[model samples]
Target: MIFYGKQSIAQSDIDAVVEVLKSDFLTQGPAIEKFEKYVAEYCGVKYAVAVTNATSALHIACLAAGLGKGDVLWTSPITFTASANCGRYCDADVDFVDIDPSTYNMSVDELEKKLQKAAVKPKVVIPVHLAGQSCDMDKIYKLSQEYGFKVIEDASHAIGADYKSAKIGCCKYSDLAVFSFHPVKIVTTGEGGMVLTNDKELHEKVLLYRSHGITRDPKMMTRTADGPWYYQQIELGFNYRMTDMQAALGYSQMQKVDEFVSRRRYLAKRYDELLKNINNIHLPDQNEDTDSSWHLYVVRVDFSKINKTKQQIFAEMKDRGICLNLHYIPVHTQPYYQKQGFKDGDFPNSEKYYEEAFTLPLYYSLTDEQQDYIVKNLVEVLQ
Candidate 1:
């Protein structure tokens, strides 16, 4: 069966993991640092802290930004729930901005309007890089400066993407940026994530928070160490460290990121060319200043002209041995968030996008034949 997305594991990836398996350390080893350094250098960032998953990365990054019970954190409603839940984990109230209709990223215009009217402005605003295309970050950065807020980019689908010639995780316009390394992502670490930042203090805080807020450093300890083995628990943290095997695999995967992204971009262009004449669907839009990694080629079906419901199209595609998936349901529409006083109509654009959109198969290994077949089946169903 054709999956909506999947990893492309080569012999090198297997060899890297096997090497780590035969090494002295498995959990907290040299491989993790090596992987982190490679990602940092690739993204042109000063530091990168690899963690168990993107959720944990976002959690620690939020804490590093001084998010607490009384603070507010805002993100796009169209993202995975983890983007908003990170704020909830820190005891900070979470809110969402509407998405831009064209790009499906957080709307900077909506953000500025919300900030102008908010009685209590958010301490942090996370602009998610939806479908690997960046939100207008220069504008977001300007707003952050004017309104005294921090920016964290939820770049889970954007590790290989670029905005204004700079890499997504460079943290040029945000205080911190996040990347996911799930099997389905551009890079795979089995299941891992990284938080990138230019600030040394933020990096230090992230390091402390990832492993139970414990510090082995003499400078950070409250009192003198009794021995070289003595460590201090300065604050509460979690066991969010990446394993050596995972890091090694991730490092190996990073070596071929450009190739992976290039193939995906080529496939995306093919889809645009083949599907452009179809009147019943809207292809993914590109922003002038960004080059997307094309993690998921999402399309909006114009159900107004079609007689079939969204469910019918999904079933038809599945019957053809093709799997289709939605990127997200609006976060505020979830039962948990609804109970928090957010209702369906609160963010009209996000809710509207949710009703019509679903992802097509887009990944490193999707060949031209498979893509053509997928498009043929899609056109047949939509027609």
Candidate 2:
């Protein structure tokens, strides 16, 4: 069955991992540094810290941002739970800003409004790049400056995406940005992530937090070392280091990111053309200032116009040997978040989007013929 997302692995990817297995160091080695440097250069960021996964990356970024008990963190509700959960990991109170209907990203207007009225402003605001399209980072940055909050971009779906000529991970509009390298993401490291930042202090903090807050560096140490083997646990942190094997594969994947993004963009345009005339189906909208990576091709099916529920449509697609998926359920609607006092109508846009949207097949390896077949089945199912 054709699924919503899949990784495109080349023989070189395998060779890179195999080569790492033959190398001297498997874990805290040169390969991770190499991959980090490559990604930092590609995104035009000053520093990068590779980690085990995006969730860990987010957690470290939150800690580095000085998020703690009594501080508040905010993000778009239409994202994976990790985006909001990272705040909870820091013992920070988590909140959500509604999304822009057009971009499916955190609305700067909503953020500013919330800030204007809130007695407790957020310590950090994480605007997720949903479906690989960037939120209005320029405006978000402006708001952050005015309100004195940090910005951490949840760029898991947007490694190869661009906003106003600069890549998403440049951190020009945010203090730090994150990228995921899961199998279904733009690039695969068999499950890896990187945090990019321009600030040297934040970069150093992220590095410290990702690896148990330990430091062997003399400059960061509280006292002089007794011997070369001296180290100290400076602060509480997690074991979030990425393996050399994963970094090696990621480094190799970096070589083909441009090609991968190019193909995804081509497919996205093709889908737009193919679906334009279809009835009662709204296409995903794009923001003029951003170029998306198209990690997901989600469409809102007007179930009210048709006789079927979303489940019926999903079942029909599955019967055609296609497995579609939903991008998210609003974070606040989850039982855990509801216990935090966020109710059904707290964020209307995300909830509405969740109800109407379902992702179509999208991946680097998806062929035109396969896409056409999927589209045909979707059209039949919708009818």
- Per-prediction backbone clash count: 0, 0
Lowest summed lDDT window (length 10), candidate 1: 278-287
Q: In model 1, what lDDT does residue 364 have?
A: 89
Off by over 4 Å in 2: none
**How accurate locally is residue 282 in candidate 2, as Cα lDDT from 0 to 100?**
94
What ranges in model 1 sit over 4 Å off? none
Candidate 1 structure lDDT: 0.95
Q: By summed lDDT, which 10 consecutive residues of candidate 2 come out lowest?
A: 100-109
Q: Per-residue lDDT tens digits of candidate 2, residues 307-374? A: 89999999999999999999999999999999999999999998899989999999999999999999
